[model samples]
Target chain A: MGEAIVVTSGKGGVGKTTTSANIGTALALLGKKVCLVDTDIGLRNLDVVMGLENRIIYDICDVAEGRCRLNQALVKDKRFDELYMLPAAQTKDKNAISPEQVRDIVLELKKEYEYVIIDCPAGIEQGFKNAIAGADRAIVVTTPEHASVRDADRIIGLLEGSHVESPKLVVNRIRPNMVKSGDMLDIEDVIQVLNIDLIGIVPDDEHVIKAANNGEPTVMNPDSGAAIAYRNIARRILGDTVPLMPLNQKKGAFTRFKKFLGIGG
Target chain B: MTVKSNHVTIKGIKDGLVFLLDDQCEFSELLNELRYKLEHSHQNILTGPIMHVDVKLGMRNISEEQKTLILDTLKQKGNLLIRSVETQGCVPEDEAGSSLHTLCGLVRSGQVLRHEGNLLFLGDVNPGGQIICSGDVIVVGALRGMAHAGADGNEFAIIAASYMAPTQLRIAEIISRPPDEWENRESSMEFAFLRGGTMQIDKINNVGKVRPDFNVFKGV
Candidate 1:
């Protein structure tokens, strides 16, 4: 059966949407048929960041209501053949859908796609529940900050209780300068608080912002550190144990095995 | 599954109520009967002195589903002393976060309800359920469930019981228990108070000094 993965973070502005877009794109580039669902419902961003906002004629609500077929609501990514996005309706709130319904939709999608990556909202409220109800695994994204880490811990507790234990961790936006100066929590501290295996450690790359502004995922950029991290994470999802990339250390530290990853972990 | 204990004697125990039902009848049928009787025009189940119920099952015992139905039926009958206990991977500190009562009438297992103000529990607090407070935690009936006061770092919090014997008891960080050596001791009226960051519990005596035997007559 296809695995349904959810990208979630309890605190807002921890790059959940950005991770969702880039990770889904990276997975599709790996030749896995992936469907990205923006389950935030009202305050949606998968469409906007994907730069497919203007092309949307139908949203997820229309599919749920059966006004359109699932195929009709699916939007193809221009860059990847297998990647598709089901955008949320800005006009509706989270309560417009049911958890059972989300589960049913994910179950149906499992039959057709290799992966269904859901973009969860920023809180532990209805939106979060709606996004994760059908997920088999989850990726908790957090900044290297105490508040975000604490909220991520709480979300991990909820996920464990809600039958989605063993969620992987993604530490986004690591500014090496600040971490070295002890002004911010480093990767080790975040991992200790979260107590989970690390999947991605994305550096604060300006290339990501540029790519987003240009409607392209940073993962599409060959030299971008964030893109490389996302690609590694996507490879790790395929059962490859890619070592985490060294940050601010010598680039040639793991040079022998680096090219063997071949643009992956 | 039966109503706990092979022999159930429906009788008065001190000022409390105890209905012992033998483990023979289908729990659903028994609960349906209780609900019907309580809702009956002549029989007012809520007005009587609150009762304590102990279900001792035999052999296969009652299914988790049966126990849930019984608890729900008791709640529908106005008030229930028997609370649902979810013993799976929980701790004593969880008692601070349980309301077991209804802000909404629906109480689900594994869901914790924490209120900071003076608390009133309209329903039974199940075993896994907790009712911890910075103020007084008042269970309107039999308190066979777990409860703690001054959970938000309040040391003066005192825990009162209609019928006192919890699987675990806590007031703030202090934990109280009947002496570990005495497992068979049962009680009806007891109170636990925090003394020097440790919990000390004693039976409340209406006449003289607090007596430990006062808890011997069980079921609130």
Candidate 2:
């Protein structure tokens, strides 16, 4: 059976959906058939991040309510032939469907796809319960902040109760400059608090926002630092032992001087 | 199958059935719904000669008057045997139900763990999580959450951990804290217990150094 992994973070705006879109895209590019399920319900944005919102004729709610066939709700990705997206309903609240209903939909998707990526909503309410109910594994996304790490620890606890594979953490929005200056929490600080296996460490890059605005995943840009980090994460998820990305890439004094002179940075 | 009500949710627990009261519903509506469920929808499990049900209030700070309103409603209904009423923050008296509970994993934020007896945790307790027990509390790993060792007012209860930097610690009715300078003592293992009606902390290595009068063990 295919693995159904939920990308969840207890705190909002920690890049749960962004990580879902990019990782799903990266896995699809690796020749794996991936289906991204946006379970955020009313706050659906995975479709937009994947640039497939306009193409969503049917959604997860429609499939759960038997308003459409599961195949009809699967929206094909424009960029990857093997990738598909199951968009969540924009109008329906989290309570529109139960956890059992979501579990059934994910089980069905597991038959045809190698990976069923669920984009979970924030908070540990009914929405979170539904998203995790059908997940075989979990990817908890967090940033290098006290509040975010605290929330991530809670999410990890919840995931552990569900008996999924120990949830791997993805520390998003890391600024090397801030870590060098001792202004932000480093990977060690986050790992110390969470005490879980680390999967990826994505540096803060403006390319992620630009790609999202264009309805494309940052992983599509091969040269972006964030893209390389995400690609490594995708490989790690596929049972490949990949070393973590070095966030502290120190710039030489000559290179810094050249950048100050407006030369190629 | 049991009834599913918006005001109250019922599920079969180990001790008995648990009635969860949703805080969002109107108080009157909640009472009406609770009465209706007990009368009509309890046919499936309530068919037994004797039944015990525990009521769980939602995870919110409830007032005294509200607690009485719920208790009065359940008292009036003689059909189901009301076992106990579990509030959100109040630790139950029977925390010593299990002689000892050994949890092999970390306790995360927003999770409340209560035991009737001693609690032996094998992992860390992150901030925002709580462990309340009527007996002693022990953690093999770091203890950084709220721990109430004497929830049932047992003054002799002690809380021990490898690295104790708890956000809040309590023994019996007293809340004592060591100096902030003691935090981050990685290699030191410490235990906190009540002595002369005041909580005192001592390192495991220096147990014999404590005052002889304070070393007296109380009867369980």
Candidate 3:
């Protein structure tokens, strides 16, 4: 049976969907049969981030509602063969389905895939309840900001009540320089508050934006800071004991900015 | 089943409500008697106080069929609280009935327990956390999350944070972000409130010479 993993964070703009796309893609690259489900009903962004919004003719809602077959709604990723995207319906609201329905769908998907990753919605409401009903494990994503970490903690607490055990934490978009300068909350501060086992730390890299615009995940890139972190995180999930790359070990920002601008720092 | 003073008494507590299921007292006959008793009682069915009926569930000398029939009858009313005479474990009053052994915080997520009086936090409210109280908010720790006092269009609400850094701080929708430049950030506890329809954070201080009308918490 596939291990069902739900990617959820109570706060918006904390990279839940982005982490879902990359982690699912990375798992597929590792030869694991992965199916990424977007549980955000009305406001869907996983399809856009995955760059498969246009190719979607049917979604998980269609399959759950019996309008389309489950096999028909699974969108194969362009980059990986084992990776698939089960998108969410944009027209209907969160009440279109129930927690039991999501569980049933997940059970059926488990028979065919080795891993099922659910991208949960932003708030802790019915949509969240439905998304978490069938998750065997969960990954709570958060930035280094106080608000994001606070929301992540609340999400963890809710997951506990829902009987989801061992939900991991993924600190995303970490900028080492700002952390060194004391401008942003460091990874340590975030980890202390949320109190979840750390799964991965993804460094903030501009290549993420460029890759997203091109409908590509940064894990495909070999040298970007975020890409390297994502790739390392993927290897860690596959049972590789890789140490986290040393962060904030760089020099001045003026020099780094020049390199980003490609002006010969 | 024999009832006295609104309390039903069974022959034995071990095997359901028993009153000799012999041919004399049929299940239908017992139902007619119970219905007559409830109809005469002075209690509203839906809109009034809930009726807590006692029931004994188990089997001893009673036949399996009789036990099932009695249990099924109790399920229909949905108002019975099964009590076991074996241990007297009546519904197991837990901390809000959570199977888990953790002290579930009284204020759960997605629920805003508004207080028209005063609200205080014993610990810090991490982000995605909020407290919208009508009076004053006193945080025991650094208030790094969002808080809005006087949410019901009352200007009397005031938000006080020890560290005073919040994602969103508001007093009746007058919002303020901690200044982008932290050099001027106050070193003491600050309270955000509305004056002339603008949110203002005045440092809490105690002094003899007629200070700024009120005192806010000071961060040492």
Candidate 4:
């Protein structure tokens, strides 16, 4: 059976959907059959992020309500044949489907897919519960801000209380320059606060937004830093010991000159 | 006139009247004598202003029903109001409030770990996490969250942490200032306590100086 991994963040707008899309795409690129499930229900966004909105004939709600077969609800990705998306219904609320129904759907999908990725909605509500119902593992996404880190910590605590294994953390949208200047919380600080195993760290790359706007996942662009980070996370998810991507960019002329003169290490 | 055996003796003290019941006599004889003494005592003693009566059950193990019977007999005397019942020897330690409890794990945000007695947590308390203890609280790891020691109103309770940067610290009813005003970014271990109704944070090394009785070691 395939493993179900839920990508969640307690707070909204922390790139949970982007991370899900990129990771699922990267996994498909790694020769794995991946199925991405959007559990946000009425507030669906994963279908759009994956550029599979037009292809969604029947959603997760239709599959759960027995209106359509599981295969009929799945939308094939235009880019990767191995990647499929189970879109959430735009008209139905989260209460339309119970956790048991979601778990059943995921179990049915797991038989065909190598990795079933569930995109959890923000907040610890019914949507979040439904997303994590079938997940064997969890990935908590957060920004470097204190608010995001705090919410991530809360999500980690809740995940521990559930039957899922200990969740890993992904610190997204980290500004390296801001961290070096002591203006923003660093990776170490975020790790210290959450106290969870760090799976990956995605830098604050402008290309992520551009790729998302174009209805393409960042992982499709091989040159983007965020894409590379997502690929590394995908490798780690496959049980590969991929070293974390370095956060520091090349030094400036002044800084290199100072280092050459032995003014600072 | 026959020599009367003193089974129950009443003595007057500054605060109240002490009813010294004999420990060696049979309980039935003691009860009969006590009843007779209260019934035949001087009228002035029984009719005057209310007198606080303290019953001292020295070296006697009495049941709840028997103690209630004694109190009822005393209450029959109109002017005698029973204040307290005293028993000698140490009380049993069956209560969880008097023992130490150890918890080993991370206290994450939005999680509250409440305990009745002393708590020895072997993990970090992240921001927004809380620990409420009726007695002392000791965190062997970092304490970045809120800790309220003496949650049940014990003013002598103390909270110690290896890396003490708590967002809030409360000892009994007194709460410390915000973390920004604490100015306690020292590298050494620290502990918080209440002194003179004010919360104070000090190094763990000085805990003995502040509370000499805190040490449990008598000697080797």
> Whose DockQ is greatest here?
4
Candidate 1: misplaced stretches above 4 Å? A249-265, B1-220
TM-score of each: 0.56, 0.72, 0.56, 0.78
Per-residue CA lDDT of candidate 3, range B31-129, in tens? 455554444533444124333444332112334675556556544545444443221222122211222111113232333445554466655655546
Q: lDDT by residue for model 2 over A135-199, one digit each (tens)? A: 99999999999899989988888888886788999999999989878899989978877899899
In angstroms, the error of model 3 at A258 is 20
Instruction: Report the poorest 10 consecutive residues by lDDT, candidate 4 chain A.
Output: A246-255
**Model 3 chain B: worst 10 consecutive residues (lDDT sum):** B95-104
**TM-score for candidate 1:** 0.56
- Arrange candidates by lDDT, highest first: which order? 4, 2, 1, 3
How do the residues B1-220 of candidate 2 rate in per-residue lDDT, one tens digit apiece?
3435567778887767788887555777777887777667757676655568888764334668877887777666555688887654322334423367787677788888888778888988888888888788989988888889978888767788998988888988998666687665666889887788988888865543432212333111
Candidate scoring better on DockQ of 1 and 4: 4
For residues A119-215, what per-residue lDDT tens digits would candidate 3 score against the true structure? Answer: 9999999999999988998888999886787678878878877778778888998888798789999888887566668889988888888887888
**What is the model-wide C-alpha lDDT for candidate 2?**
0.85
Distance (Å) between predicted and true CA of B85, model 1? 45
Best by lDDT: 4
What does the TM-score come to for chain B in model 4? 0.54
Pairs clashing within candidate 2: B95-B115, B95-B116, B95-B117, B96-B116, B96-B117, B97-B116
Give model 3's docking category.
incorrect
- For residues B53-139, write the lDDT of model 1, one tens digit per residue: 444332214557876775676566444475223222111234423343334221122335677755656544433446666655655
